[model samples]
Target chain A: MDPSRLTIAQASAAIAQGSLAPLSLVDSYLERIASLDGELHSYVLVLAEEARERARALAAEPSRGPLHGIPLSLKDIYWTRGRRTTAGSRLCLDFVPAEDAETWRRLEAAGAILLGKNETHEFAIGGPDFTLPFPPARNPWNTAHYPAGSSSGSAVAVAAGLTAGALGSDTGGSIRGPAAFNGIAGLKPTYGRVSRRGVFPLSYTLDHCGPLTRTVEDCALLLQAIAGHDPLDPASADRPVPDYRKALERRLDGMAIGVIRHFHEADAVAGFGPENAPNPAYCAAFEEACRTLEKAGARLVDLRLSPLLDYADANRLIMLAEAFALHETDFQERPQGFGRYAFARIGLGAFFSAADYVEALRARRELCREFREATEGVDAVVSANATAPAPKIDTVPLWGVFERASYTAPYNLLGAPALSLPIGFEDGLPLAFQIAGKPFAESSVFKVGYAFEQATPFHRERPPIAASLPGRT
Target chain B: MAEPIPPDRFTVLVERAGLKLTPEEFEELREGSRFVERMKESVRRSGPREARLRGVTRPREKTAEPAHIFIAGKD
Candidate 1:
């Protein structure tokens, strides 16, 4: 099998048994990035020399673990010791941290090769704004379409086979948004499930770090290396890390799956404009996906919680307010350093008074409780990953997040484990849905997502860009 | 329809955010202000009827000491 085409499980088994050389594996991915990244723009930096050196070093030693010799990318927001960590903003473009992000440290300790850093929205709040120092990542499915971000490059990298997996931090749909648009697998582990120490904070409370990969099982592999208690991260949960990969083999039989359909319906939630509603193709695909799970012996039940806008409003208030607070000094000092979209969006955070923030937090608590109660009987909850397929890059309106409710934001609010993976295609673009579990229930989320992934043919499909590349597909 | 934040107040808020934008940048942000207004209004309309003095409870209890505290998830 082409090194780039091998799933993490396959490649890891090959490397563990010495059938595949780590150096050659790194070379294969580097070559793929060299060929496809010009159009994909998935990476801000390509540490080719360093990656080769790391792979050479790993191949010299006995296998360390499943991630040993695996090539992975980090979203630029993660602080890498002695490496430029630009949070996709010109500000701090030359900044290098003295210590590595906890996630980076874990991956490196597990013997994963760092291919480079993926691009992200400025400070992870900036949307796919083009005026940034680096070009925003384009959708691999359609180069002209936007790859939803701030995990933008991470998703594109995985979707285009530029890397085996990449790490993305989700505050408000950063990981899942890009995952859906790029037709890959992304996991936003429960907040505190993965440490955020050394990663740029958008909202300390809502931020989650996880992986974007070609398959759900690969996501579990990446998560295992990164998920654990971190004393350095105040938010890190002190909990036993479940064997996520082992959990993937569990069948969904007799499990109750909660379906959140109101989120995709027009009249069900106010402020969700018609354009923001899930398209007919996506709706049909999601229904079929539910039925697919049903055939797998999972019981599907209709579930409702608070309206989607309630979660959206609360999440936006807390995120922007915290983001504004973090960047206040920088914005006040170097306003010109930020892109227009980021400045406008983060600046709006100033309008949120302490009272507004307090109220939003209170509402968040209520919503979280509501979500817990609503899903008590179910093992996992599923919903449309994105309201619609990726729109053209030129058509993504600035501040569009406020005009529509995000199906993914509710999970962030509850700090639940959420995974987004390709379900099917709509109008030639990828369509996706999210499978989420209660806080700290990533194993359950992975089990459901892996079952669906194995039962479907969507993961087998590659982007048109990949088809055009020589020796690809 | 919810009313947009008034232009005068919006201008004050922009300065308060410590941003000094060019005329073009300021105008662009002025348009974005409508979206911000909607977001604030949404929160206002959806806020819980009663306020909690202590604010939302921390989803997890912090460790008494600087020790790792792990919350076990159900299988």
Candidate 2:
């Protein structure tokens, strides 16, 4: 049977039960990628032979874990041996890592088949830019719309049914932003839950690695396999790995959810509210989805944070400071090699002082505390996954970074777990909502999310783009 | 308590941090730092000296309890 939309956990169970052949499953994805990628441009490279070879080996072995024999995409920012990680910029177009990122080693051990490397915003900061060497990956639902970034390709690939799911890193909404507009589920786990040893750093202190999937259980399964203590990653959490997959089976009978309401009323992705925002219909859809989620099982409390613009400003500053630190020498030595957005944003890091960087870190810690206290009695928090629907691809401006704050960055400041899940759609555009939990409390967030998803039909709806693929549906 | 990074030191900090910005990038950073400074105040004023901001977190250890961990069909 074809494996286009199966969550990793679902397919793993099917393969283990002889319901789906692993080799055949891999072939379905390979064919889908070949046929659809020409238009979506979601992948940085297509590793057909390598993936097939691995798939053949997995076919012989008993499925090892939840993601066994499942096809999964890796973001370009992730370092993989023998694969080019361009980070959506020409500067790293040919660079390959000799060692797998720690997460890669874990995913392989879990037995997930490699689909290929997905595209990203340059260096996981600036993104969806057409000016880069490769065309920015477009949202699969509406090819003309934006697919948020720097988890751009991973989100689109999962949304468009190019692969079962993908691995993405989020520093400031890179994972959740793309997931929202692409109509997939993304989990930005607690700051240190997943190791960042091999993932390229945008901001060392703020960077987090997690999964983008079609469902919450899939995210739980992926997180189970990849999350644990890693000696190589200084920031890796050393806690015992809870049975995250099992947690999904638990009830959400008494969980409290707070609503981060400020962004929806006044903030827009491009700087205006529903009335002034480019897509009013999309905003209405987002509200209706929240109402439905509230009715399903979650208790929605009205909560407010500072303007997203303030959080966005601080986040951009910290990202610049740290990313510039990572690329300082390369930038000074070969400025021409970088994409325009990377050049502008990372280059801005040059303007930050040691005091400024430290100030940002201190502020980040404070915000994390404030957000944590706000979540004391609540199981998770809810908010718009995006201010509006994805903007038209070619029309996005270079300086659009400064225009507004993002809903995704507040959690980044607080080092909390923020997950984005599909809620509803209108005007051919998808709207999403975030379920955020306290620091290192991803399982609770997943439980709340999985319960809501189990009660709703949003994840059941596939984009029209998947119909163009062979045997996908 | 750590004093927030002053606005005037931004140029040297950016240069030291090793970014290559045009004149405009510098101005954006200057403007952006206004908000960053406010956030820094929040972190600097955290409750206690030993609040410990940097501890590694992990999942709870699994126990020997058997069938409760796995629900029928729910898995």
Candidate 3:
């Protein structure tokens, strides 16, 4: 059996049934990483020896849970005790954390083996920067293309089959954007759903830690292991986490799904430019995805709230204000320590006044209220995740993020659960759409995403890099 | 429409932010300020017109509060 190709659920089941040994699965991924990651640049550090030791140790014990023996990577921003956690900046090349991030500690206790640390955009806010200590992760579909970041390596690792799953933090569209570009399943759980303690902060109010996996079901399994409140995280939700996997069986029949077509077809384009319009192929794929959901007995409703730019601007302002505050000392003491992208992007925060930050906070409240009221009658809302497939890496301008209105940022502002799953392909690259639910309504989002995933083959399709492997072909 | 921060003004802000940048980095950030101006414009345009018109001195509806709130001593 090829353990490298199995999803987290399948590998867990195999390990539980005694068909797949934990060591073999870990070895499978390590070997794949050795063969592929040189060009992909997905991992900043590969824990081959540590992973093998852990796998052997787990092999001696009975199954711990569904994630038992599963190998996964984490974005470098997540602190792993005694492991170098570089947040992709040269400033912390040798910095090591004294303790594990709450999320990583939970994953470890659940019997999942850590394979490595994935690369991230510097401080999780920078663009793909060449000046960083590590090279930016390239898309698996085509090396020359961009892998939407700062969870760039997490999505690349999963999509390239280097790891069964990865944990990533999302502020704005970090998780969902890369997931869309890589054609994997990425979830940005409702704010405070997962503990962020020990993970480097981008924006205190907007950051969320979640899973990136090959399929929606795998995403659920990973989320189950990580979700819940952590007292250490002041913002962690105190609510109980539902059985996300079992909830996946819930049908989409008779569910009300809001389709925000204007987000991509009009608002984003009007705000950016004609070049920012979603590709025709992407539009067709989104239409087909809507049809697939409708066929699954979901009722599609056209919904509109605040313009996309409103949410985008608010999200950006808050993120910048908070991020700069956190990194101000670094920016001042050693401005040259930062990569060019991180330096310039975070520097923009200094231009905004104290009143601007407070205004953004107020705007956030209004946008959230508007979203909740508009989505009151709907179980979930669907929209384009990325308007186009990954573009040439160099073509992306340093200020490109500011130039476009993100379809994913509205959910970030609302602190809602949003999932990005593959819908189709455009020009051999992946195309994806997002399904967002009310705050803490990940189950509804999963139900809608799973329904569409099962009806389409997009999730099952592997990137060319994965397919080109000798036996995989 | 919002105009980008003037170069002299941008230089002062950058200096006040305590970031010492190369001329190249400064120029890049100066160019990037246009987007910041545009974003500031959008944010200024958001929220209730009554609040903005009153210059934010008027009391807002009781239930309308900032998204992030702090309750001192509450955990």
Candidate 4:
């Protein structure tokens, strides 16, 4: 067996059964990173010795659990005891924490190995800015295109198979965007499903900590490790942690899925001008994908809500105001510690009056209500994750994220669970669909996601783009 | 949004944000602000409710001895 191809469940079974040694497993990933990461530049820092030591400890313990000795990467925003989490900027280059983030602590307790801190958009709100100390993480599929942000490195690192799985935060589609672009599976659970105790805040209201893995099963395995209540996290929900791993087997049969055509319809009306509309090729593939799902015994229906741009705007204001409020002191003191993009964008919060933020929130409430009512009877809302295939990194318009109200942002506003799964392909580039469930319906989303992944081969194709050498997407 | 934010105001906000925008960079930002403004306008219409930044919440049923020491946030 190519040990590298093993999903989280398979690897966990192997390790627990004494068939896989932790040191050897950790060493394999390290070798891959050394051989492959030079081209990808997906990581911010690589902690080889630390990982080896943890793996050694797990191997010595005869009864380590399933996640025992798994090597995982941390998106740079998550604080670690000794590692500097730069969040793809120079501001926090010297910042180190005394404790691991709650997710890191839980994963460590379950015997997972920390591979290293990976790169990301600055402060979870910047970008694939080249001016940062590290280059923006290039997509493993096509090095020339973005892997997406702010969890850029987390997605690319996992997609390129540098690590078994990784932790990433999603405030406004960060986890799902990169996962979709990289053609991997990711779960952005309900806002409070996972604790954000030690992770840097983007918009405290919208931010969620979740996992990016190649398979939904892997995501399930990772969520089992990360989901829990934290008295420390003020927004943390004190709900009972369900058996997410077991929930993967739940059937998706008879589930109702809504296909949103509002933004797609409106964007088309605006005339995405040939280069930007859903590529005819992608649109056809998407229809075919829907047909396949319906034939497989799931109800597919047309679903639309208000224009996507409206939801995105609410998300932006909420995120900016909250983020700026978090950084008020820093903005005053060491303003230069942040990169130009991070400072300028987050700084807008300052210009925004408190009334502006409150007014935006009022709008968010209505949007959330509309989203809930629209999705009332549906188990999941199926929508295009991207309008088209990954575009070139340099071509990403400065306003790309803002200009189009994306299919992903509405769910963020409603604080629902969104799973981005690789559904099919367009040309050689990957294509994906967004499956959103009711708030805290992570299990439902994962169940359908796992079934779709099982039925498709999209996850099998690795990015031809190499880490050591860049290629155009 | 209003004759495109003036280059001089761009200079002020750029300095306010402590960013040193080259001529091209400044121009890009000025243009980008249109998108930003559009986004802001769109978000403002999200429908009225409460605060944009979510506030803290205490557990519904406090533990007999709740971890009295609330974790101090890192700004």
The candidate that wins on TM-score is 3
Considering only N, C-alpha and C atoms within 3 Å, which residue pairs clash in candidate 3? none
What is the fnat of model 3 with respect to the true interface contacts? 0.65
- Quote the B-chain TM-score, candidate 3: 0.66
lDDT of 4 by residue, A1-473 (tens): 44555677788888888897878777777877887888888888999998898888888886556688788999999999977876676877888888899999999888889999888999987876777898888887778877888898999988887889999999889999889889998878898889999998888789999999988888988898888888889878888877876766434678888888656645433422234467677677677767766765689888767666567677777787789888888877777677767866776665555656765666676676677888888887777778677778888755566554466777777888899988777656778888888888887788777767666688777776423222211
List-wise, what DockQ does each model earn? 0.23, 0.11, 0.47, 0.16
CAPRI category for model 3: acceptable
For candidate 4, the share of real interface contacts preserved is 0.27
- The lDDT for every candidate, in the order shown, is 0.84, 0.75, 0.89, 0.76
**Model 2 misplacement above 4 A:** A249-251, A266-283, A468-473, B1-75
**TM match of model 1 to true structure:** 0.93
Comparing candidate 2 with candidate 4, which one achieves the higher DockQ?
Answer: 4
Worst 10 residues of 1 chain A by lDDT: A266-275
TM-score, chain B, model 2, is: 0.49
TM-score: which is higher, 1 or 3? Answer: 3
Indicate which candidate wins on DockQ.
Answer: 3
Give the worst 10-residue stretch by lDDT in candidate 4 chain A: A464-473
Once fitted onto the true fold, the runs of candidate 1 whose alpha carbons sit more than 4 angstroms away are A267-269, A467-473, B45-75
Query: What would the per-residue lDDT of candidate 2 be over residues A1-473, giving only the tens digit for each residue?
Result: 45666777778888899888878788888888888889999998888988889888888997687778888889998888877777777888778889888898899888987889998888887776667888889888889888888898999898888888899999888899898888889999987789999888898877999999999998998888888889778777789888887778434667677887657666543232233353566567667766766676667787755455545555766777788778878887888787767776666566556765655555554555557666777877887766567889887766555454477887886778989988778677778889888877888888878887887788877889876454345
lDDT of 1 by residue, A23-43 (tens): 988988998899889888999
